[model samples]
Target: MPVAALDDIRAKVGQQVGTSDWIEVTQDRISAFADATEDHQFIHVDPVAAAAAGFGGTIAHGFLNLSLLSRMAADAMLVPDTTRMALNYGLDRVRFIAPVKAGKRVRGHFTLDGVDEKAPGQLLIRQTVTVEIEGEEKPALTAQWLGLIFT
Candidate 1:
């Protein structure tokens, strides 16, 4: 992780900050996500059944892919040292553009969309994140993610 000054972070607005390394979406991962979320949909857990459903094989749940944004951000995004901690604020918008089937690789491209001071010590950080599925033309999803960092 890199600690950046507040002023330096402000300068990165509207620009891509970083991209995370590729992460393989394996069956185990999908299963784990499903178990954790109690979303054991057939398409997400049964390969044979999912194969017949036109997905070719079991596909990761859209929410499963969406939940990975945090790990992706932690891998590549820089945080200011003045910030004590960060919290998930909310998403302005999110779209599932494509399916993330099992055995595919994915990574996130993080862009600093905007930043605003929510209060005296907390700031709202807005970011536009694109989760790109490797070897695929279309992305898995795009979301306007928000976070509140307390200084």
Candidate 2:
């Protein structure tokens, strides 16, 4: 993670901050996510069913990919050195543009969208994040992710 002064991010708005290394979306991870969520959707859990249904094999759940943004950010984002903690505030816009098939590698690309002082010790940061699926033209998802950091 890159450490920056709290206010230093203001100038970086609209620019790419960083990108994470690729992570393989394996079947085990997908199955665990499905088991945890109790979502046995054929497209995400049953490779045979999924393969017969049109998808070459099992695919990842969109929400599973969405929920991984924090982990991905932890791997790629810049945080304020003075920050005490950060919170996953909310998202402004989110689109699942494509499916993340099993066995594909994915990575998150982050761009700072804006920053504002929400309080004396808190800063609201808006980031545009795209989860790119390797070897694919279309990204798996594009999201306007929000966070609050306490300094």
Candidate 3:
């Protein structure tokens, strides 16, 4: 991961920092998530049942979409040049505004919301993120994500 100085990161507050690459939401991937999480709701694992239920086909789980933010951040989030490591501090707010159906592609748009120097060599960064579904006006989810960077 390329790194940026703390001051450099802070300079872009309230501005979009990066956008991640698109990731296809395949049924196989959805099924794997279901198996791993034991969230085998038919709407996520059964295409027929999901279609009958009016979702058109299997829709990925909300959590599944949320979990992808970490992967998305690898490409979209900035890392302070002086940092030794960064941790997922948590999310402030999250909303699932749209369903991501199988075969759809999604990517994250990240904006630097805020940056706080909690202490020397420790920084708390907040980002506003939107997980956009391909060809859709509404995003799959939006969140206020936080990270703790240790320099």
Candidate 4:
């Protein structure tokens, strides 16, 4: 994607930036996340047990779902043309509202919330992200995400 002017990016504050393409949260992906995090909870790795427990089947971990924001942002975020790099600053708030079931598809809707000039050529950008689960009434998660953009 082509870079955008800083003014153009700033103008997007308080408006929806973009919606990312849907991403399938498969069992394999969940298992991989469980392995990486060493969190093999039944709800996340054991389908039969999870089904018996009323989750219907294995579900993705909340952190796994949260981590997917990186991929989602790459597909839909706006960047300043003079940017040297962008860094994950930190999240101000994050809430996992619903579980993401295995084999379900999810996508992110991003809205630019605020922007501050932290330093010369350095900007702190805040975005509100909502991760929607396909065919679900409620979103999987919502977060106030932060990024440090170095121009």
Candidate 5:
């Protein structure tokens, strides 16, 4: 499944492709992220205080949810034979729709928005990502992401 041509890619509009991965938002993971980003917020790292404060448990950092895009995208976007390298171009829109509590499970759903030809052998793809948290009304995160693939 090499990178498709602009015309072929265009034909995929309105199509949705998805992959699900079980991700655990553990306390240790949250704590590590807090330390790495220097964001020692009690709501994210202090389980005891967070529980007492009414959240019932610690929460994951917003960026942690954002950072999972690559892993999720890898599962969703499939470019078989033709593409040699794929690079994260950037993101168009990103929103944290819900909180991801520690010890919860989350998964991602992807929908292809569009793909454009940037130059010869280069294509830019735009995809909408929805990260769902088990038993949650709102998704953990919703984002429009971009990628550049070279053939």
Candidate 6:
């Protein structure tokens, strides 16, 4: 799918635009993230402890789930030729609704919330994102994200 034109993109507001990709959240990935962020909480780093504690196993950090947004957004947006560049502006409302256990499979769903012209060939888009964990009732994260695109 090519990137939508500015007008077409704007027209996407109030429309659901969704994409999903399978990603494995492994213990190694979680541990690496923990090391990078210096967050070695037992629930996130100690599988044995976490399992014994009834969570089943160590879980990925909430921020780790948040960090996956860019990857998810790429899957959901960034269609070929839709934009020359897409810059992550920031996020709006974000919530960690559920724990993402290590070794779990997760994907994201996106909906276009708003779009605005920034320049002749640029647009600002607001998208709502939900990171869904396989078999989980609640999503891992829910966030309103922003991005700038050069058409």
lDDT of 6 by residue, 38-125 (tens): 9999999998999998989999999998998877766676332567777888988999999999999899888889887878877788
- Alpha-carbon runs more than 4 Å astray in model 6: 78-82, 119-121
* Candidate 1's TM-score: 0.95
Which candidate model has the greater TM-score, 2 or 3?
3
TM-score of each: 0.95, 0.96, 0.97, 0.97, 0.90, 0.89
lDDT of 2 by residue, 1-151 (tens): 6789866777788899999888889999999999999998999988899999999999999999998897799787888898898899999999999999999999999999888899999989899999999999999999999999899
Tens-digit per-residue lDDT, 1-151, candidate 1: 4579989989999999989889899999999999999999999999999999999999999998999898898877767789899999989999999999999999999999887999999999899999999999999999999999999
Off by over 4 Å in 1: none
Count backbone overlaps in model 2: 0
Worst 10 residues of 3 by lDDT: 1-10
Displacement of residue 62 (Cα, Å) in model 1 is: 0.8
User: lDDT for every model?
Assistant: 0.92, 0.91, 0.93, 0.93, 0.81, 0.83
The regions of model 2 sitting more than 4 angstroms off are: none
Model 5 C-alpha lDDT per residue in residues 42-111, reported as the tens digit of each score: 9998889999988898989889988877777766664524677889898989899888999998888878
Q: Which window of ten consecutive residues has the lowest lDDT sum in model 1?
A: 74-83
At residue 103, candidate 5 shows an lDDT of 91
Clash pairs, model 3 backbone: none
Please estimate how well model 2 matches the true structure, expressed as its whole-model Cα lDDT: 0.91
